[model samples]
Target chain A: MDFSQIIPSLPSLWDGMKLTLQLLLLAVAGGIALGTVLALARMSNSALLSGFAKAYVNYFRSIPLLLVITWFYLAVPMILNWITGEFVAVGAFTSCLVAFVMFEAAYYCEIVRAGIQSISKGQINAAYAVGMTYSQAMRLIILPQAFRKMTPLLLQQTIILFQDTSLVYAVGLIDFLNAARARGDIMGQSHEFLIFAGAVYFVISFGASSLVKRLQKRLAV
Target chain B: MNYNWDWNIFFKSTGIGSEIYLDWFVSGLGWTIAVALMAWIIALLLGSVLGVMRTLPGKVLPAIATAYVELFRNVPLLVQLFMWYFVVPDYLPEPLQIWFKQDLNPATSAYISVVVCLALFTAARVCEQVRTGIQALPRGQSAAALAVGFSIGQTYRHVLLPQAFRIIIPPLTSEFLNIFKNSSVASLIGLMELLAQTKQTAEFSANIFEAFTLATVIYFVLNMSLMTLMSLVEKKVRIPGMMGGAK
Candidate 1:
């Protein structure tokens, strides 16, 4: 009901928003880079490569992101100790970053695979006829076209990623939602701060998705 | 690190009320299934109505429906859950507020908030699926129903919805599976769902790998079995020569 509490809390909430944007950007970059490799591996002729890629995608897709975040949170320090023979402390942000990137890569791999498959096979053949090596053909010809076709979908996934970054709260990360709730706990206006946070999330995600829709429409032609 | 790998932790007691770790997982599974199944019913029903509303022959109703979908779809489910849990109770009337905050069991309150939040969030997605299913039908089907003197309502009831629901079985099945996964979010608010139970077990026993691995396998088997069951339903109801039903 009361909206006045939100103004005083904007500073903390902005810090939270920055952290969210950081996770979103890093995850998108890492996920797409890893996903591109997985997609290529899945599409390659070797059965072992494709089989590994398939299993990776299927396993991640079947589980929830919250579980993945929790798993990484618990596993990273132990895995680090195994490598270094000493216990290492990893921050919540770092663990969540690894979790998001790994989890999102599986989804992006499927999207990128579909995008690559949409390109005509003759294009790859023509590249071969021109004496281009497979990597050269993929990097120069196939991937460029696939990226263009996949842009709208990739952006849409990024919007979803933006929303999902809020899950970092599971590990006690000071993301946007957590920041808002913290401020609310202090101000005794928990309701107002939460409603305000919800609105801010709505505006950003809804606006981004609308832009994606427009881009999808333009790309279709 | 030479970590202890005790596969028998599930059989050990938690030192409180004589309950074993396996009991935690079983109860957690029960809560997960209860929350997901209850929410799915609400989502399916409300989503279908909103889907039909968006396609109706009016500007206001469609706009309202579109706004509902966009509002629910864009916000993160966790934020929505927080709002429902921590905020919504305060806005209720005094007696209801007292009942929600003071009279109701904390676990029950958390469960109600999570179920409502998940249902609304998933309903937005289901609305789109239903809308697409309805729109994918050839226009002639609806027009022909009207031509035969069927009202719009009757046409939807008798002709359109049955077909639309049939075509969307595959996508709807995915949504159904997603509800189970999304139900895990309930844990963040202190509901002892599967993920929460897994975390508790890991911390209590210090067998992190075994705990998470078991939860992961449970989720995988649950999803795979649901997919198999839905595919069987998809086959049983497939209309010959229909778009998705075609081999």
Candidate 2:
């Protein structure tokens, strides 16, 4: 209930929020990029490419994000060491980011696939009739429409990604939640700090989701 | 850099056949299922009520339901779990607080907190799904029930809910699977669930890959089976020439 304790700790919390935002933005960007490719692969004619993408999406989607973060946290350094001839240190931040990107990509792939499939096949046939190559048709025609149709779902998923950034605490990454917990522990006002942090998360996510709803309405028109 | 891999550690007893690392995993799996099942009961019951309230013919109830969904759905489960585990107990009456802190078993208390936290968190999502399912029903469905002398409650109970449940099987299945995955967050509050047990085994044996790989495979199996089971249920309950059926 007391805002006074949390006010004095805003500076440290902001530092954690920056890392949290960094992870969220980077993961979302990487996830969407990879997800688009995976979606296309899933739709492709080749068995091997589609099979690999399906397996990747299924394996990632089936597990807990916490476990994925832990796995990458523990395994990435070893993988890096094997790749290079030196002992490489993948920090918790990097490992967490990698895990988020990899894990979220699976969900995003499904969204992107649904978006692409929503576009009428006649449009693609028309593009081919106009002497457009497959890649050109997809780039200039299909992807643009698919991306537009999927913007709201994409934003909704981003809201989910924002909430899940708190899971980085599992790997000892001091995200916004952990930062608040640390300040609370120091001040013996764990309740107040936690309540404040929860409110902050609510406001941001609720705001973002409403924006998505608005965008969805506008797109409907 | 001596990274030892001991896959056999899973079979080795902790001490004189008391238990093995694999036993920890099995117990953890049991707790995970128990938590998920209990939370699922809370979610279905509460979510249905909230969903009905949102669709009712009043402004106040729907507003309250909307607020509840927005509040619970927006916050991360980890933060909510922390609040329930660490903060909620403080708000209890002095006698109850004393009993909670002094008399109750710590593990049982942790388990209850996790189940409650996860249930409320997921109930918000289920509320949305239920709302959508109800809204998707044809107006004539309810109108016919009213014409047949059914009250509004009877209309919803007999005419709407059955069809809504049928319509929402797929999403509900996904939500059910999600709760199972989300149960992993309970490990943060020191519940020795599957993920926590995997972490324990990994740290103890220093074979992180072996331990986590086993955990991942177990999770994958659980999720895939749920997916298959739900799909079968979907097929069984699917309205003829609707939803999943080809016209």
Candidate 3:
């Protein structure tokens, strides 16, 4: 509705989007890696490892992401200081990154677990027959297939992560949504700017989802 | 910053003997449950109707349902919360707007807006689960009901819906948990829900660790119990040899 406000504010919004993207990319990479380890741990023969991973995933999954962000933003620095005997300032970005990575890892762990489970047990055994260790077998044989099957799902979760990065606004981070809000308040067009931001969010998410749907279809074939 | 841990501060009064910090968490939990339950009802009712619409015999009905899902589902809950808070009040009729803005208690008004926002957002997701449930049913069941001279509504009520609902309980459970978790976003709009209370206590006591750790444990307990309850219900309602009800 207010094209005038949105045009000049594009740069500001882009800067915000860059931060959002940075959060997204970092979390996805770190989360998936952590998630894969958690998944493997959950599937491992050792009850201790499996139990720890299960607890981590369950605890993270049960709590709200917003709470996790708040907790980490506040508590991480405190814990760091307690350990080091000096006050440490963990910025909003790092705290949010840590929260997202940890939180999203649980969801990603489930996805990766399901993907790995879908692969036949025989395949892993066969890899073992060739004298590969568990990690080596998983890396050389299972992971490639699981990653392929899980790609669309991982992307879907990434879309969710993209949308969720907005919550960084809670801890005083200037993510895209907050940036738009800032610009909007400055220009006395908060309503229009918010509407525009919402539309932008809808388009990107909808577009990404459709792409996932397409990928699903292609993978099906 | 030498911070002394005060685990007992939750039970102690906040220097005035008016209320313990834990009282804030209790009330916040109460509001959280109220908001989540009310929103869950709306999600179930509206979601089922929209889901039914999506699966109906008409083209327009499905189209409308599709649009509703796309519009609501794609937007982040936080943005939607903001819209409901700031934008929707402006669009209301003048008297209603006044009631929302002036006549109603600030907390009550915020509660109402949050419930509506959360319900609508969740309904979109629930709609998908319900649709999948209905479509997952055997086509012959609906046809059989119709052949027995049952109206479409009767067919759905007696034949299709009962089974579809049973099939969807697991997903619906997750949706229920989601509503509880998502209720945290209401704090952004100044509703003193659980997360908000935890933040407030952390700030007041400087025992951020104890406060959030306690909140996390409570959330875990709530969610785990819900999961256990739903699993029991699923087991009870499980129609043997059915798609989702299989043990």
* True interface contacts retained by model 1: 0.84
Ordered list by lDDT, greatest first: 1, 3, 2
lDDT of 3: 0.92
User: What docking grade applies to model 3?
Assistant: medium
Record all residue pairs in model 1 with backbone atoms less than 3 Å apart, i.e. clashing: none
* DockQ of candidate 3 against the true complex: 0.75
What candidate 3 gets wrong by more than 4 Å, as runs, is B240-247
Cα displacement (angstroms), candidate 3, residue A48, comes to 0.6
Lowest summed lDDT across 10 adjacent residues in model 2 chain B is found at B238-247
**In order, what lDDT does every prediction score?**
0.93, 0.92, 0.92
Q: What is the TM-score of chain B in candidate 3?
A: 0.95
lDDT of 1 by residue, B141-218 (tens): 999999999999999999999999998998999899989999999999999999999999999989999889889998
Model 3 lDDT tens row, B155-225: 98999889899988989999999999999999998999999999999998888888988898888888998
lDDT of 3 at B154: 97
Ten residues in sequence with the least summed lDDT for candidate 1 chain B: B238-247
Mark the 10 consecutive residues where model 3 chain A has the least summed lDDT.
A1-10
**DockQ of predictions, in order shown:** 0.88, 0.77, 0.75
> What TM-score would you give candidate 1 relative to the actual structure?
0.98
RMSD of each: 1.3, 1.7, 1.6
